[model samples]
Target: MAAKAHLQEQIRQLPHRPGVYKYFDDEGIIYVGKAVDLRKRVSSYFTKQDHNKKTQQLVKNIKRIEFTIVDNESDAFLLENNLIKQHQPKYNILLKDGKTYPYLCLTNERFPRLIPTRKKINDGSRYYGPYANLTAMNVVLELIRALYPLRTCTYNLTPENVAAGKFKVCLEYHLGNCKGPCEALQEEETYNQYIQQIRSILNGNLTIPKAYFRERMMAAAQEQQYELAHTLKKKLDRLDDFQAKSTVVNASLSNIDVFSIASNEKSSFINYLKVMNGSVILTQSLEVQKKLDEMDEEILPPLIMQMREEFESDSKEILTNVALPSLPLPGVTVSTPQIGDKRKLLELSIKNVLYLRKEKESMNDRSKDLNEVRIMETIKKDLRLTELPKHIECFDNSNFQGDNPVAAMVCFRNAKPSKKDYRHYHIKTVIGPNDFDSMYEVVTRRYRRLVDEGASLPQLVIVDGGKGQLSMAVKALKDLNLWGQIPVIGIAKRLEEIYVPNDPLPLYIDKKSESLRLFQRMRDEVHRFGITFHRNRRDAATLKTELTEVKGLGPATADKLLSKFKSVKKIRELSEAELVAEIGKAKARVLLSYFEQQEQAAE
Candidate 1:
């Protein structure tokens, strides 16, 4: 109680200005938070009643509070993010998959080398992209190499070394891939011109190179250098292709950063797009786990600052989907446009974040499917089956008092239902709800058709009964010469026991095992499907009988009424005019009188 009052008193004394705050427990810093007003934000924790369990626990454990007043909200945001990155506070949200993405580095040297790196150094070098993946980075590097004859050797390329003629040109120079800068065969000024064009291309500005190549191609053609002109044309074509693929936005909107966020109950997804000279130079999507229920206004600003620092974005203008509070940063404009190209760019960023969210969901679903496949393979090995049950079909018989007996077969492919492949059968050549005989007929009919039609077969077949049903299915398979070719088993409903042919002892799978759960799912699905089909058939039969009993209603009339109205009750409820339109007036009157008499009789 004393601690609570003291914390509240400290909160009341807090300055009403932008700052970062740290919550301390006995062990260490439990959480770090930032706010525009130190007093209002810090006081809310002790005053508010509706915090999430994690936040509530954090507040409970707070033994001391510390804060540092910043100049404004932007500084506080940057400071808070830096502190969180450094300390990784227990209660603060953190990026789960935070690792530096790869960048294409152009080294700062007389003969600079183009290489892919994961680290960014500050030694006067130019880096492009923290590219989304290595393949993209490699594509850019390949394009650069094909267009320009840059030196691949790591020679000093110092004026003194070249003057003394101390180095020799390598095989790259002989192959016409390098300009032989090591042997002073290429002028530094000419090489740097190529470097400048390459840099422009990497920055999503291809006009410089395209124009230069166009001029060179025309000059070579005028000089009657046909081969050289063709080479230049090919380079131009490559540049055009690269540019066409790279640019996705309006060329007039240049030097802007796009940030958009999408959040759910558990995590937030933020996507960043760096547009330079109207081309997207960099793109990244990051997911941060939500440790507390923080609003987007609170979550996005800090993330924007952090991403700006991480990507080293210096764009003065940032576009978002919503208006942001003014930041303390000098000369930065954050705007949410309602129309025009900027709005379109904002929409694009939102689209990217949504796509990334969907992609992550799809990836998680695929991972789950892979795990299920592994489980099924384990089941196959454990059961000593001939093949993995990539496709499985389960059969169950349904009947109520030997009326409208039917069977259903549910198909499972890759551990999920294939509804299109499911089959339903009306009992033929079997009667009185004999489970074994019904199983025999269904299995024989299913496989015989597959064999005759040359259709693919399931690796495993399941019968939803015990040993008797198993034996019957085995006989049917043997009749079709498929007994030993396909594995068949039966599951008993009472004990959930599995029975195999010619095996007296039943296989009792562990109740908690995924294999058993899979079998249970198959059994339940077949049962449900069989029951639904049986019910539909039974209802149709009942309707037909009831219609036949209606006086003055012929079989043809009954069929037409059932085809139109679908049921006797529905036909009875139709207006006299509607009924007359379907049948004749005389039949319509008769139908109305019959229903009236029935209602009166019920009363």
Candidate 2:
């Protein structure tokens, strides 16, 4: 408590300005975060009572707090990203992927070779991309090879080596894939020109190469060389297909970056698209596991700065679904579009982010289902049960403020609802709002019938009320001599404390535990079942009472009308002819006359 008071005093001294803050425990920095207002953001940790498990643990460990003031939000954003990278605080979100993306490196060698590489070192060679997918890099490499006869072999190819015949051309030269640059048969100037053309294409400009192929194809056909033209036509088609697929917006839109973000309780997803010449040259989608409960807007700016640096994006203009007052780069233009091609491009980026989020959620759901099997194990441990509660039943009693009392039992098998085994019972032995008596009657009837029929019994039984209801259920089980054969417990409404058969004090399960969640789900299911049954019974009773007042109409006839129209409201709306066809003229006239008088009296 003294430590907490000191921390509160420290928080009171924080300035209301934009900055980065670091949290330190005895071990070291556990978390680092950025905020628009230092005092407000840092205060929220101690001020808010509701936090996720990880946040609670983080707050519990903090022994000290520190802050660094920045000029504005942009500096704060960049500083936060750099600090996270440099320190890698234990509680900060980080991307899970480890594969370094591939790049097309133009090597600094004689007759420079085009190479696909994952490493970018400090060489004079220019690196084109850190492609999100290796396949995109390969397609570009294949197209470059098909367009120009570049060397594949790695030789020094120095003037002295070429003159001394240090290397000879291999099969590549014969196959028309290389121009024999190692043998000095191809000039350096000519090879460099082809390299320049490849660079242009790599920058998402395909117009020159496509035009060159089309012109050559047409010229060859005019020269009466059908085979050569056919070959050129195929290359042209490949280039056309590649261009068409990559061009998402107008082809004239160049040097632009688009970003979108989506977040849920656990993680944030961001998608980036680098557009040049109106085609998508690079695409990346990243998932950041959330810590400290950051919102979507708060998470996006730092991510944008990080991704822009990581992907080497130099676009002057950016499109995004999120506003960017925090990202105040001097030369950069960040805008959220309402209408036009820019809006479409922003929507496309958002679409990719949403799709990625949905895919991740589906995978998490599958993982959760597999993880739920462990929940049964957790239940077994938490309850000190002899075996896993693979089959469990929960009981709940419902009424309309002490009328129409009923009880329901819902079954769960393998941590999921087993609706087929669910049972709803009218309170046959209990009068008024006597939940304990109703629980006793339902428990005895349910298990005795199961025992007589030789049906499998549930491993665990739960009653919705506290010790009173649990005592009744326990008594029923003992009378049937099944008390020790099965486990029965009750949950109190106030704190959800679990009461066992003979225990005076309740056992408290962790609120965040999946076992507790499973228990809560069963409680909810039984409550729904009981309430629905009660409503139907009460409604049918009222309808029967009114029908009994119709002189010739009995409950049997009332039931027939209810089965057909589903409610008395619908039965009262039926025409004379419709009612007569069902119950004959005499009974129909009496029913209609009674309904008319009832409506007139109400009016």
Candidate 3:
């Protein structure tokens, strides 16, 4: 209590300005936060007036506060995002991602084909909008197919076919989107011109298409094809209407990104509106908690500069980059316009900002019930168990070939990892890289130790492998006289597959199923932990040759220093002065000279 009071006093002395803040739990575990006014924001949590149900809960658990003052609001915003991505605070409303939105891609081939996909491949393909609504995207696709009856088929029309005109036009040609190049009804030069026009339409150049359609309609009317002329005119009109609505937000601007930042004294939110060809294509929000003052301007300029630098260094992901202050260039009206299209875009962006703020407030209210309580309930019913699986133990084995085999067992309570209960074992029973046997040994050891201590057994055991691995697990449970007493299941490697005993092949649980994704997440985490442990073992084993039997350097510290420096050759190359620069000059000079002397003796 005295220590916490002292920490509170320290927090009160912080400046009432923009900065990042962090909260530590009673156990000294840190959760990061940001604040616009550090003094006021931090002080608010300790005051009786600020004690809401959620704030009171946070204050009760908080033991200390730490802060880093930044220059302005935007700096605080960018810093907060970076920290959130790093620490992932429990109280923060995190950005959620499951399945990626599909993109419409036109592949670059002799005969191109349009495809819908979530993944962005490196192959030469032109991708368009991350369309917010899939139904609308499909509508566009249908429209394209109806209007451009090109070869939707993947078949290549070779030189022989070009000369022979062997293939006949499909139903698509009759609809209109394509000239039957496969049937050689159109010359290559003429077909290429149509392709060029399609590209122009995609680039939002409406004039060329309007002119072409009008010309076609006029020619048909002259030839007394009244029905064709009227149909073409109707299609042309529809295209114009589609273009108008598409750019309702920013009709004049071609491509730009609009950013708006909103902040209260303690937190900030930035909304990014991605515009392409005068349309507000996508909007994303980033939230920041930091100290703010009236004098602070948005720090976007410097943050963007740093972002560009990181991008050049291949160290960061830059989704969109546009010149700040958005001015129109010589021939391009690139400036942030105050009227018409730009104003509409800005208005839409503001709406998005407000929408996210409201959504976050609602999420904060519901986050109290956001624990893996549902996970326990689902597993309990799924296994038809006597009690809820409040405590789950998952096991995984990792090895490279036959070397440095290791296994890990992770415990999850109420759907979160109990880090204190995680256990790793260097394979003792298994001599080779046999995952099944290794899993059995790992499970046996973990359970046997709990039994020896008279501790309660976990309600479930999850193996991170397929059916064969599950069989080994079942055998282990039988040996302990606990077969079927504790529910067990296996998660297969490929396609997030799952398998149970007596089941044929593997079953895929839908991504929308929270319980299933939770189980898969646990399995993946255990596998990752095991793999990490195995890598450390392998690295240690390989670096054994570089270790010094020096008096002051113990194996653990030697390993730490080696791991820190990576290789002995690099360590040897590091000058006595350089070594001092890295670890400390005192250790460097002595350590380097010692190594040099040893090397001379060995020679």
Candidate 4:
């Protein structure tokens, strides 16, 4: 029989409920999928019109179809994600290029110390970051060593085991980054406090450390320890270098993800950035389209979701490899909040995107277009920004009926992703697809940190949509007492129109202008960021929701099964005995009965 005929024949056996489906090519390579309505979703492949080139090609390669019915779409989605990760089917675009992201580790010893490593070291000490870039991570490490002057010796320096002649402080002490703790030149109590300060700063809680430093400086001055006070002053000056990079202000937010999307004639790029505490931790870039092939839905939102899944998986790997610091205060849970420092971080991500776009435009033309330079100059003047928004920031929101509402901020420094700075925000405030509320949450979370610190701000802020989002962001700035001082604009989707704050009709800068390209890129990146966050949240929610409907399953058991097996097909492959061995016999039996009933219903 023809491939379509075989698929249609198989579809006739499928249940009209949530389930996972698999397609096998002649070589028996399997591609896995999940659908809310397996019967309807699979049947569309055989009967639906307007199949894209990728789908048609997929259809042609299929030699057989297989499916397992589930109780709901949530199960199907979870099963599908797991299956895709396990089988790595060619059809599902897999994210996370396969290696775990790196994180800084500090061993849990009586004498805790910091070091750079990828694997999780849960010995006892604090872990600082799954930092987005190695430079940023290393810079913090260097700063900690310089400012704290703690030991970095590899020899066993434990109190019970320290040998008189076994070890001494390395050359680091001579260079002034260490306090020579190896030789007991530095007291254990004092060094311990310095280590605490380093960990605190890396976790994005600096207020306590700042205060501690001030108190110590004052105490030294009162004691007439002129040299010690001056040294403390120098250390305080060094702390400013940390501030020179990014100023993250405190907000009541936790664990928020931000995203932004941008596109040109050839391809669209979505940037996903996540902030934990006040730190910008990770950034991801997703290709929205490849060649002429594209997804059926409009590109912005779906692609963003795809990136979020990739980034989230990466995040898990990071967390496992790096131990989290203990919360500074009780009742302060970890949350990806929607306001304060989080919002500013999101805006910085957008500027990174715009900067890249502008760089591309400038290089595309052999000659420096004077008009382009003028536009750039005008942007600098209008924004009162120090640099030619040679770096720009933008924001956008994506959601489906409030379920997976998300916001993204992409950076365009010199018109490229700054891939280092792009961020995604999982919307925390608005539900039910309220774009304005979502954007407001994102802006406030991202920027409140910077505003609180009184740090220099991004050159410009752009929104992916039109006046409404721009006004929403503007209102946030104004409320924070940051209105006219910073430039905010919007990019309308249909005509590639630009809307600056207070400007009514859309403004179209020259297509060839670098400044225009920069703004477009920023807008696109934020859209991509927002969409990716929404999709991942939606798919995750769907999976969680549906899995709950299954008998004899709780969230813990479901999460374990999904994490262990990663797919329904794999779960199906396991015998009841194997399942019972992993979970309990009772739960295993319940699962078996559930699958059996679902299969029977499909039949």
Candidate 5:
């Protein structure tokens, strides 16, 4: 109670200005927050009753508070983001498990060297990307190497060393893959021109280099230099192909940065698109783990600033799906468009973020499926089967007092139900409610057709009965010469005991084991399927019997009525005039009178 009073007093003393605040526990800083008005925001934490679970926990853990006043909300926002990144406070959404991405660095030297590095140095060098991934970075490196014969050796290509002829041409020079700049065989001006063109290509601005190549190709063709013209044409075609693969949005919507966010309960996915001259020069999606219940406005601005700084975007206008608070950064306008080409661009950004979310979900689903496959493999090994039971079929019989007895077979492939392969059977060759006989008839008919048509057979077959049904199914398989070819098991309903064909006693699988659970699921599914089929058949039979008892309703008339109305209740509900349109007036009158007499008897 004393601590609560002290915290409330501290909140009361807070200044009503923009600032960043820190919440600390015994260990260290646990959370960082920003607010436009420090007094109101800080007081609400201790006063509000409807806080989310995470926020409530955070409030309980906080033992002390510290704050820094800023000039405005934007300054507070920047300070808050920096502190979160540096301290990575416990109750902040973090981009976990990622190192700084790799970028193609061009060194600041008289002759620049292009190489991949993970660090961004402040020396007077240029960086093209933090590329989408390592593979993309490598591809760009290979493309640059092919386009220009640049030197790869890390030699100090000082003018003094080159003029003194201290270096010898290496194998790369002889193979015509390098211009031998270290030996002074390549002039500085010409090499710098090639470097400039490579830089433009890396930046996704291909117009200048592309036009230069096209003009050279045309000039060479006019001079009748067919080979040189063909070579230039090939290079131009490669440039065109690369541009064609890039996503291009509206041509006039140039020099803008786009960001969109999609979030679920646990994490937020943010996709960033860099547009230069209306083309998407770069795209990246990042996932951040949420530690507290933060709103989109709270999470997005910090991330947007981080991405902009990482990509070195200097666009005057930024586009997003949600409106952003005024940022402290000068000369920048952040707008959420409602119509026109900018809105379309915002829609495109949203589409990319959604795609990234789906891709991550799909990857997680595939991992789960692989785990399921492994579980199925273990079941196969434990059962000591000849082959992995990738395809399994289970059968169950259902009947009610010897009426409409039916059997159903449910198929499971890779431990999941395969509904299309499920089959239903009426007790064609069995009599009464004899489950063993029903099992035998269904098994024989199922495998007989499969054998006749040369269809694929299930690796395992299960019967939902004890030893009696198991013995009958075994006899049917033996009669069909398939007893040893396919493995079969039976499960009892009461104790969940499994019965194999040649085993004297039942095999008791552990109740909690995955294999036993799978067997139980298959048993329950087949039981449900069989019961549904049996009920449907019984209802149709009862409807037919009731229809035939009416006067002037023979077998043909009953069949016609059943086909037209689907049920006797539907026929009962139809008016006499509506029935006359289908049949004649005489029959319609008889049907109406029959229904009236039945209702009066019930009353």
Candidate 6:
């Protein structure tokens, strides 16, 4: 109690500004976080009753609360990343994969050999790609071999060694695989030109080599050397094929870094693509496991910083799926591209992450835990819920031009739909296209009635809209005192940003995750259900006046046909045979003649 009082006092003294905060126990700093408002954020630890288990435990151990005020949220995030990494906090996400990837090292020598190596030493060697795809790297190596006849030997090609006749040309030279720089059979300048061209290609500038080949082919043709021109044209074709294979966007993309992230219950998978001239020169994927339930927004900055450091990337422009306020890099432009070449690159990076996520999931499926229980566990972890969401319900609102406003709730148990528990709600209190108020009213009515009837509430609640609808739902939950008893999430339709109640940043579950698929399935089910109900209600309101007036057709038959077909417009589009199947031949002919008379009158 004394420690709690002390921390509350400290939190009260905190400035209401954006910054990073640290929690310290008797030993040292154990956890770190950032917020746009330090006082409100830190105070939530004591005030909120719905802290997750990890957070509750963290709050219990915090003997001291320390914070640094920054100018904005971006700086706070950057500082939090640096502090956690420097202190190695116990309750921070840990980057786990430490395996060294292979890089194509071009040795800084008289004869630079393009070779694949995992170990990097600061010996003036230019390394390209810690390639995520080894086959792609091998293809590049083969292309380089076909383009240049560089030596593969490790013999010292020093000028003194060659001048002293210390080395001799071997079978490689005879096989046209080497220009034999060891014996001074190839000049250093010519060998360096070959290395330079290879270096350009490695850096994803096929323009250099392509232009070289094109110019040579043109010169050969101009000199009337048709056979030589044909040979050069073949090389040009090979270069074009290689370029087409490597490039992910238009040929103008250069010096832009791309990063995308996907996460499941425990780990975040990040894919990084270093683009040069529309080609991905370096592709790498990393996994970071969560210990403190950090969000994608919190995970990405450090991941980007760590990756940029590991690869020594100096690209001025970075494209990502998540939006960052600012980066530690100076003079860098970071954007989340919605459309254009950069968007395609970002999408390709996301595809890479999705593939990695699927591969990891496949490996996990080999274990025995990938059943119904595992799905609930995954939902619990991925959504950061305190308990398993075994019985989940999702809500969606539907309206046609602010008419016949209706909402639906679809229930799922054990990761499958429960049609018996499905509900459709008509808008009663609110009118117009106000989804926010409609959601609040529906949630209040549903849960309050359940409470009054002493019925059990669902383990999880999901709303289909962005922050506005989510906030309304949360308000309803709080008003009913069900906030701490149940967990609710909202899924935005377009971007799929999962909004939680207190957290400002949204969570992005992996696109391929079963948990996310469950949410989507529930969402889609509600949309379908809600729209169907809304249309029926609207038609019913119309039929009370319009269906009774159809001449020679009794109200019973018109109501039956309209209710079955749902609308008169749809009934008109039906074939006579189909209409006969519903209302019989004589009625079908009368309805068709009525429609024909209406069309003739209009004409």
Q: How many clashes (backbone N, Cα, C below 3 Å) per candidate?
A: 0, 0, 22, 82, 0, 0
Give me the runs in candidate 6 sitting further than 4 Å from their true place.
1-3, 9-19, 25-28, 35-37, 66-75, 96-99, 133-136, 217-234, 355-366, 369-603
- For candidate 6, the per-residue lDDT at 196 reads 80
What is the C-alpha local distance difference test score of candidate 6?
0.85
lDDT score for residue 413 of model 1:
92
Clashing pairs in 2: none
Each candidate's lDDT (Cα)? 0.87, 0.87, 0.68, 0.67, 0.86, 0.85
Which model scores highest in TM-score?
2
| Residue 575 in model 2: lDDT | 92
List where candidate 3 sits over 4 angstroms from the true fold.
1-19, 24-31, 35-51, 63-76, 157-178, 183-186, 223-228, 244-603
For residue 215, model 2's alpha carbon misses the true position, in angstroms, by 2.3
- What's model 2's lDDT at 413? 91
Best by lDDT: 2
- How many backbone clashes are present in model 5? 0
Q: Give the higher-lDDT candidate: 1 or 4.
A: 1
User: Mind giving the per-residue lDDT tens digits that candidate 6 earns over 1-603?
Assistant: 124777878987999999999999999999888889999888888788877788788888899989999998778878887787778888888553334766789998878888988888899998987676578778888889888888899998777888999998889999989988888888888888778888888877777888887998999999999998998898889988876766567668888899999988788899998887767777888777877576787788888887887777899999989877677688999999999878888999999999999998888876534587788898998987887787898998988899888899999887778899899998899979999999999999899999999988999999998889999999999999998898999999898778898878889799888788878888899999998899878878786456556676788888798767777788889999998898889888888888888789999
What TM-score, over all chains together, does every model reach?
0.62, 0.68, 0.43, 0.51, 0.63, 0.56
Q: Kindly give the stretch of ten consecutive residues in candidate 6 with the minimal lDDT sum.
A: 94-103
Global CA lDDT computed for model 4 = 0.67
Clashing pairs in 6: none
TM-score-better candidate, 3 vs 4: 4
lDDT of 6 at 371: 80
Q: Supply the global lDDT for candidate 5.
A: 0.86
Angstrom error of the Cα, residue 157, model 5: value is: 2.8
Residue-wise C-alpha lDDT for candidate 3, range 488-564, written one tens digit per residue: 88887776776776776775556667667778878878888988888877876777645655655557756767877
Q: Could you tell me the TM-score of candidate 3?
A: 0.43
